[model samples]
Target: MPEKVTVSVTDEAVGRIDEVVAALEHGGMHVDQVLRPIGLITGSIDTQRVQALGDVAGVAAVERQRTVQLPPPDSDVQ
Candidate 1:
């Protein structure tokens, strides 16, 4: 599983994320070229800067970290 991260959202940032979602669903994810939401959620950067990108109106998702338990690596399959 991928690590979770938090991203701050502004009114401006979310607009762009919506566009990207649309593109990903139809235009083959081209919106990823300049601004992408993954960077924010992945903790590579802050959401404020994302909003500064202009095209994005606001941020949508901000995943919070959570704890989970599972079998350790190298364990035999059930």
Candidate 2:
């Protein structure tokens, strides 16, 4: 399964986000969004490939995306 992830670009790499994105893609990431101002790249990749993303030159961190589900407004659990 493809796991969604958030890749944080190193401070030194923020100016070269495009290159970072390219490297990530080369590392098997399916690019989704490039939040340049924040130096973050969001994407999905095979779970096994996630560790490879962290080894990319410009990557400072790679974290799997997590989701939180909430019940309806009327639900007892708030």
Most TM-score-accurate candidate: 2
TM-score of each: 0.25, 0.88
lDDT of each: 0.40, 0.94
* Top-lDDT candidate index: 2
Which stretches of candidate 2 lie above 4 Å from their native place? Answer: 71-78
lDDT of 1 by residue, 1-78 (tens): 233344444546554655544432242222323335443423322333332233433445544446687877878955
Kindly give the stretch of ten consecutive residues in candidate 2 with the minimal lDDT sum.
69-78
The weakest ten consecutive residues by lDDT in model 1 span: 23-32
- Per-residue lDDT tens digits of candidate 2, residues 1-78? 999999999999999999999989988899999999999999899998898888999899999999898899999995
- lDDT computed for candidate 1: 0.40
